[model samples]
Target: MSTIKARALVLEEPGTQPVLAEVDVLDPGPGEVRIKIAASGVCGTDGHAIEGTHPLARWPIVLGHEGAGVVESVGEGVTGIGVGDHVVCALAVPCGTCRQCRRGLAEHCNSAARRQAMSGVMADGDSRLRYGGERAYPFFGVGTLAEYSTVRREQVIPIDPALPLDEFCLAGCGVITGYGAVMNVARVRPGDSVVVLGAGGVGANVIQAARAAGASTIVAVDAIPEKLELARTFGATHVVEASADVAKEIAAIEPDGADAVFEVVGKPELLTLCLSLTRVGGACVMVGIPPVGSKITFDAFTLTANRRLLGCRGGAVVPARDIERLVSLYRGGTLNLAGLIGRRIGLDDVFGALDALGKSTFARSVVVF
Candidate 1:
C-alpha cells in the first residue's frame, strides 16, 4: 500500500498536550475507505481521551471522531461508496455477526473485532497512521482531526452532499447521542415530560430531541445561566439553575415528576439524584460519559417504584439506520443542527476548544478543515 503525508493532532500520551505533526497515512485496505475530512466537532470525548479517562482510550492516537468529509479513496471489495462521495465518519461500527448486533443492539456490540476497531486498529490489527516511525492509533477509529483518515467501511457513512459538512459532522457523535437518547433509548413519547441536566453541547441536543419526541415539558438544568438561556432556544420549556433544589424545581414543572429524566452531566451523585426525580414508573437515562471505573450509588428504594435507571452509550446508536434518519431530519427542518454550533475554528485553535469541554458552555466548537 502507498503512504501519504498529512498533518494530524496526535496525543502522545495521557495528560500531555496534543501536537500537530506530519504523519504517514496508509492507503485504504480491503473493506476500508480513506476520507478527506472537511469538518469535525470538538467533543468532550476527545478531551477525555487526551486525559486518559475514556474507557476505550488508546495512547499515541489521532484525536477527533465527529467528522464529515468526502471519500478520497476506496480499497478492493469496497462498493456502493467511492471516491467523491460526501460522508460522515461514524463512531460506532458494529460487527454484524456479534450476538448484540444480531439482536439489533448494535450500539452495545462488544465483539473483539469491534473492540479492536474502537481501539483504533483495523481488522489486520495494525494502525493506518505512523508518527516518527511509530504506529499511531486513531481515536474511536475515525480520527477526523487529520486531513485524511482510513477507516473500515462501516465507519464511513455517506451523506447528502448539499448539507453543510461543518454542521453535519456533529451527526457522527453529539447529535446522534443526544437525539438517539430520547428517540432510541428513553423512547420519550408525545406529551411526556423530560428533564435534561447540563445544557452543554450534547445536552442541548437532548433538549431538542425531547421536544422532537413531543415531550410536553422539557426542563433543562445547568449552573450556567447563559446555558439555561441558550437551552430555551433549543426547546427547553423551562430552565433550572443547578443547585441543591434541582429536584424541587423539576417537580414544580411536573408535579408527578418528569416521565423521563436524562442525566447529561455525567456526575455520579447527580445520576442517583436524577433517578429520584423520575415518576414511579418513569425512566432515568444517564447520557453522560463518567470517568472510567467511576462508581455511583443508587438509593435502593428508588427502584421499588419501578423507576428505571439506564445507561446510554453513544445514545444506543445504530449507525446505519440512525445517521440516515438524522440527515433526513436536518433536511426536513425538524432538527436544529445550526443551534448546536457555538463557534467554528480552524485546526490551529483546537487546543482552546478542547480545553473548554467541562467549563460553562452551551454549544459545540467545530474545527473546519
Candidate 2:
C-alpha cells in the first residue's frame, strides 16, 4: 500500500494545544476509505478533548470530528462510494451488528467494536496515522482537521456535490444533536413549549427543531446576549438572560413548565435545572458533552411526576439516514444551515475559534480548507 503525507492538527497530549504536523496517512486497509477534507466545524467537544476531558481521547491523537469531505480512494471491499463523492464523516457510526444496534438503539451501542472505534482505532485495531515517527489515532476514528483523512467506510455517507460542503458539515454534529433532541428524544409536538439552555451552536438547532415541529413557543436562554439575538434568527420566540431567575422566567411563559427542556451547556447544575423546567410527562434532554468523571445530581422525586431525563449522544443520530434527511430539509428551505455558520475560517484560525467556546460567539465556526 502507498502512503500519503498530509498536514494535520496533532495533539501530542491532553491539556495541550494541537500543533500542525506532517503525518503519513496509510492507505485504507479494509472496509475503509480515504477522504480529502473540505470543511470542518469547530465544536465545543473539541475544547473538551483539548482540556483532557473527552473520555475517548488519548495522547498523540488527531483533533477533529465534525467534518465533511470528498472521498479520495476506496479500500478493498468498499462500495457505493468512490473518488469525488462528497460526504459527511459521521462522528457516531455504530457497529451495525452490536446488540444495541440489533435492538434499533444503535445510538447507545456499547459493543466492543463501537468501543474500539470510539477510542480511535479501526475495525482491525490499528491507526492510519503516523506522526513524529509514532502512531497517532484519529479523534473518534474520523479526524477531519487535516487535509486528508482515512476512515472506515461506515463512518461516512455520500451527499450531493451540488450542495455546499461547508454548510452540510454542521449537520454532522451540532445540527443533528440539537434537532434530534427535540424530534427524536423529547418528541416536541405542535403547540408545545420548549426551553433550550445555552443558545450556542447546538441550542440554536434545538430552537430550529422546535420551530419545525410547530411548537408555539421556543425560549432560548444564554449568558451571551449576542448569541440570544443570533438565536432569534434561528427561530427562538423568546430570549432570556441566563443569569435571570431562569426557571421563574420560563414559568411565566409556560405556567405548567415546558413540554421539552434541553440542557446544551454540559454543566451538571444545568442538568438539574433542565429537569426542573420539564412539565409532567415532558422530557428533559442533556445534549452536551459533560466532562468525564462528572456527576449530575437531580431530585429523584422528579421522575415520579412522569418527567424523563434523557442523555443524548450525538442526537441519537443514525447518520446515514439523518444526514440525508437534513440535506433534504436544507434543499426545501426548512432547515437554515447557512445562517448557523458564524464564521468560515481557515485551519490557522482553528485555535481562535476553539478558544472562544465558552465565551462570546456564533452558532458555528467552520474551518474551510
Candidate 3:
C-alpha cells in the first residue's frame, strides 16, 4: 500500500469541541508500529476528553482509545508482530522495567504513564501528528481517531484474524472494562448474585461476565427499556426498570440484597442507591467516572456493617492478558461482543454517530474504515 495522509479528530481547546484535520503520521520508530486503523469505537472517556473533563488530558489533542486495526509497519526491535496482523490497541502500555510493573502491577507503571501522556507533541512531548509545523497530542496515547497511528509496540495485541474488526473494536475499552471488573477485580464466584446499575456498553459486559462467572442471579437495572432488553441477551436473569420502587423490586428478589452491586452510572443518587441495594458484607464497586467534585454521603452506621466500597480503574485489568482472554471467550461464544456493537458507520459519518451516542443509548458505534 502506498503512503497516505490521515485525518484525525483533534481537540483544539478545553471545554470546546473536536474538529477533523489532516495530520502527518510517521513510520514506526524503535519499539513502535504504525497501524492502519480499521475501526474505532467512541467511548465515554472520549466524551469526557471532548468536554475537557478528563484530568489526564491536555488540549489540542486527538481523543480516541477504543481502536482495532492491522499492522502496517513495524519499527526496529519489535518482534512477534508483523504487517497485516489484526490487533486491538491497548490504553495502558506497560514497561516491564518500571517499579510498579515489577510488582505485578503493570497497569500502574509510572514510566508507561509518563511516556503515553507525554508522547503528544503539542503537549510538550513526542508525537506522531503534525499540522503546519505544529505538534498535536494524541489522547490516551493511542489517538485511534485517525486512520493511521504510530504507537508503542507493546500497546497492540494481536487478535483472532477471524473476528470482524468492526464488532471487536469495542474490546479495547468498554467490553474489557466491565468484563475485567467481574472476572479480575471481583473474581465473582459461582452462584453469586450481582446487581449491575446502568445497562450501557460496559454494564452489559458486567452482566455477561457475571454469567460467565456462573452467577445465579444477575440483576440488570436501567431506566431505558431497550437497554434492559439487551441485558437479558447478555445473561441478566432478572431486569428491573429504574424507578422510585427500584430498591423494592430488587429487595423482593434478594431479600438481603445482592452480594455485589456495581454502580456504573456515576451519578450521586445512583451510587447511593447502589449502596442501599448491597447486602451486609457485600461489595459495591463504582466503575463510572463521576463529574468533578462529585461525592456521595451515607450513614456511618450502614457503612460500618462490613459493607465494602471499592473503585475499579480500567476494570482493574491488564489489557494485554485480559483482552486475549476476552477474545477467546468471544471466539468460544461465551462473550457477546458482536451483539454489543449497536451500529457501524464510516469515518465520514463519525460526527453524526458521536452525536447519536450522546442523545441516545447507543451501546457502541464502530467507525469502520
Candidate 4:
C-alpha cells in the first residue's frame, strides 16, 4: 500500500505528554474511508487521556476524537459516502451486529467499548498509522489531531458542505454529548426546569439544548465567573457560582427542585449534589466522565423519592441521525455553533490548548487544520 506522510500529535505512552511528530498513514482498507481533517476540537476527554485518568486510552496512540474533515477516498464495500464528501468523524462507531446495537442501543455498543480497551487499531487488527514504520494506534479509530485519518465507514457522518467545518467539528463529540443528554437521555420537555453544573464546552451546549427544548428555568452552576457569563449567552436563565450552597441556591429558583440536574463536572461530590438538587421523580444525568474506579454514594432516602441517577454515554447519540439534526438546528439559528468556539488554533498548539482548558475563558478551542 502507498504511504501518506503526515504530522500528528502522538502520545508515546501513558503519563507522558503528547508531542507533535511525523507519521505515515496507510490508505483506507475495505469498509473504510480516508479523511483530510479540517478541524478538531479540544475536549476534556482528551485531557483525561493525557493525564492517564481514562481507562480505555491505549498508549502509543494518536490523540483527538472530536474532528471534522473531507473524505479523500473510499475503500471497497463502502456505500452512501464517497470521495469529496464533507464529514464529521464520530468517536464512537457502532458495530451493528453487537448486542447493544441489535437492541437499538448503538450508542452503547459493547463491541465498541471492548475495542476501545484494546489497541487503537481497526477491527481488522491492523494499524492505520505508523511512526518510523512501526505500528501506531489512532485514538478512537479517527485521530483527527493529524492532517489525515483512516476511519471505518460507519465513523464518518456526511454533513452539509456549507457549514463551517472548524465550528461544526464540535458536533462530533461535545455538542452531541451535551445536546443529546437533554434531548435524548433526560428528554427535557417544554416548561421543565433544568440545572447544569460546569459551564464549559458540554455544559454550554446543554444550556442551549434546554432553551431549545423550551425549558422555562435553566440554571448554570460553575466556579468560573467567565464561564457562567458564556452560559448566559447560550441561554442560561440563571447562573450560580459553584460552592457549598449551590444546591440551596438552585432550590430557591425551583422550590420543588429542578426537573432535571446534569452534572458535567465528574466529581463524586458533584454527582451526589445533582441527585439532591433534582425534584421528586426528576432525573440526575451524569454527562462528565469521572476517573475510572471512582465511587459515588448517596442517601437511600433520596432514591425512595423517585429521583433517578443516570449515566449518559455520548448523550446516547446515533451520530448519523443526530449530526444532521444538530446541523439543521444550527442553520435554523436555534443552536449557536459559532458562539461555542472560543478561539481557532493550529495542530502545534494542541498541548497548550489542553493545558488552558479550565483556566481559559473559552468554551472550546478548535484546531483549524
Candidate 5:
C-alpha cells in the first residue's frame, strides 16, 4: 500500500494549541492495521494534551484515543481481524505475556509503561505519521482524530459492524474507564449505596454501572445543575449540587455513608472529599487522571478506619473482553450508549468541542468522519 495523506489534528508543541494539518500516513507495519477512522470523542484528556497538562502527551502528536473505525488493511500475522472489519481502538493495548497481563491486570501491563516512556509513539519508537517530512506521534498509538490511523493489531478489537461507530466509540475509553471502575475496581455489589463525583462523561458511566449492579442508592454530585440533571438520565437516583455541604447531604441520603465513592473529577480536594463520603470499611475509587505530580492530603487516622483508597487505570479492563461485554449490553439496550453522546460533530469543530469539555457543558462530543 502507498502512503496516504490525511488531515489530522496535530499538537505541534507544549503551551500551544493543536491545529489541523495535512500529514502522510504510512501503510500498516508488521502486526499493525490501518483504519479509516469513523468517529472519535473529545475527551478531557484531549483538552489536557492541547494545554500541555497531560504528563504522557508528547508534542507534535495527534490527540485522540476514544474512537471506532473500519479496518482498511492488516499487516502479516494478524488473525481474527481483517480488512473491512469494524473495530474499537482501546488505549490499553496489553502485551499478553507481561506480568500484569499474566496476573489479570492487563490495564497496567508492563508494555504500556514502556510505550508511554516513548511519548506517544508505537512500541517500535518510530512514528507512523509525518508532517512536512517530520515525524509526528500518534497519541496512545491510535490517533483517531484523523481520517485514517495505523495502530497495533492488539489495539483494535473487532465489534459488531451494525453498531453506530460514533456511539460505540465511547466504549473504547471514557465509558469503559468509568464502568470498569465500578464493576472491576470498586466491585460494587447489589444493594450497595454509591456516590459518583463529577457527573460528566466518566461520572455518568459510573452512575450507570452502579445502577446496573443493582445499587439501591446512587448519588450523583456536580457543581453544574445541568450535569447533575443529565446524570439522572444515566441512573443517578439522587443528584446533589456540589458545595461545602455536599458531604452532609450525601450522609443524609445514606445515613451510614456510601458503600463506594467514585471520584471521577481529578481535583485534589475532591479526592479527599470522596473518601470522606465512603462509609467505614467502604471503598474510595479514584478514576480521574489528575495533573502529573499533583498530590492530596488526608488524615491518617481516618484512613485507618478500614476505609480503602484505590486508584484504577482504565478501570482495570481487559479490552478484548470488556469491550465485547459492553457492546453486548449496548445491543441489549441495557447500556445507554446513545444517551451518553452530547453532540455529533466533524473534525473542524474539534477545538470547539475541547472548549466545551473544559467548561463541562457536554457529556461527550463525537467527531464523526
Candidate 6:
C-alpha cells in the first residue's frame, strides 16, 4: 500500500550498457503481491539479456529473476498467502486460461500477461516501476534485483521460515532450472549414468539432482578444478577436468556412453562433444543460454535412433509444486541447497558480481537486500 524507491539494473538499449538506477515502485494491483526482496541470485540469463544474446530478450529492461523475499501486501483476491510470508518468486506466472496452462503445462503458459513477465510490466499492460518519469521493463516478470516488486500471486510460493533466504533464493531460477531439468524433464532414474558439462551454479544443481534421483555414476565436467571439487560435495561421483580427451575419459568410465548428458555451457562445440558421450538411447538436455546469434550444427542420424536433444526451459517445472518440494528436500539435507551459494553481496554490488561471472571467481554470487 505504499510506493518505495528501489535500485534496479536497467539496460536502456540493445547492445548498449546496463545502468543501476533508483526508481519508484508502485503498490500491488488485483491478483498481485508486493514483495520486499531479501536476496536475488544473479544468473547467466540476465547476463545474456543484457548483452542482447537471448532471442526473447528485450531492451531497456530491469534484470533479475531468481529471488527470495517476504510478502509485504496482497492485492484483492490473492488468498492463501499473507503479508510477512517468506517466499520464492517463480518467473513462470501461470494464467489459468491459456491453452498451455489448461493442458497442465503452466510452465509454458502462453498468456499475454505470462509473456509479460519478461516485459517487467503488470498484467494491466502498464509498468509499476519508473525511472526519470519513464517506464522500464524487468528482465523476468519478478525483477528480483530491486528492493521491492509487485507480481501476480501465482508467481510467489511460500516456504518454511526456517529456510535460509539466500539459499532458497536460488530455487527461483538456478536451482529449479537445473534440478527440475533432471527430475522432471530428463527424469534421471536409478542406476542411470549421467554427465554434467560446466559445473557452474546451474550445472552444480543438475549434478546433485541427478544423484538424488539415484543415478549410479555421476560425472561432472568443468574446466575449473574448484567447481569440480564443489560438485563432489553436491553429489558428483566423478569429476572430469576439461581437456582435449574429455570424451575419452568419460567413455573410459562408461564404455557404452552415458544415459543422460546435461549441457550447462552453451558452446555448440561442447554440445557436439556431449553427443559423443551419450549412449544410443540417452537424452541430452540443453539448459545453457548461449550468446545471441550463435547456432549449433549436428548430424541428423545421431538423433534418429532415440538419442534425443531437448531444451529444458524453466526446467519444465511447475514452480508452485516444485519449489515447495525443493524446500522440503533442502530442509531434510537430501538436497544440498546451502552449499551452492559462493558469496552474498548487497544490491549495488550486482554489476561486480556479474562481471566476476565472466571469469571463474565463484559458483554463484547472491545479492541481498
TM-score of every prediction relative to native: 0.98, 0.97, 0.93, 0.97, 0.97, 0.95
What overall lDDT goes with each candidate model?
0.89, 0.88, 0.81, 0.87, 0.86, 0.84
lDDT of 3 by residue, 1-369 (tens): 334479888788777867888878876777778899999998778888877777778667777889999999988888999999999988766667778888998766668454654344322246766654577667777889899988877778998788888877888888888987788676789999999998887898999999999999999998888888989999999999886498999999999988889988767667788889999998888888887777788876778989888877778777789998987898788988778888887777778766765345647788888
Alpha-carbon RMSD of each model: 1.2, 1.2, 2.3, 1.5, 1.5, 1.6
Tens-digit lDDT track of model 1 for 245-341: 9878777778888899998877877888788788989999999988878899877888999998898989998888998988778777889988788
Clashes of each: 0, 0, 1, 0, 0, 2
What's the lDDT for residue 180 in model 3? 74
RMSD of 5: 1.5
Please give, for residues 1-369, the per-residue lDDT of candidate 2 as tens digits: 478898888899998778988998999878999999999988888888888888889679888888898988889999899888999988777888978899998777877887677677987778999997889998978888999999989888899899899998888888998878888788889999999999998999999989998999999999999999998998999999998999899899898999899999999789888888889999889898887778988779999999998988888878888888888878888899888888999998888888887785688889999
Best model number under lDDT: 1
Query: Per-residue error at 294 for model 2, in Å?
Result: 1.7
The whole-model C-alpha lDDT of candidate 5 against the native structure comes to 0.86
Sorting all predicted structures by lDDT, with the top scorer first, yields 1, 2, 4, 5, 6, 3
Look at candidate 6 and give me any clashing residue pairs. 53-292, 117-141
Error of 1 at 353 (Å): 0.5
TM-score result, candidate 1: 0.98
Q: After superposition, which runs of candidate 3 have C-alpha atoms over 4 Å from their true positions?
A: 1-4, 108-124
Model 2 gets an lDDT of 0.88
TM-score of model number 2: 0.97
TM-score of 5: 0.97
Clashes of 5: 0
Model 6 Cα lDDT, one tens digit per residue, 193-271? 9999989989989998998899999999988888989999988999899864888899889998999999998787778
- Error at 213, model 1, angstroms: 0.8
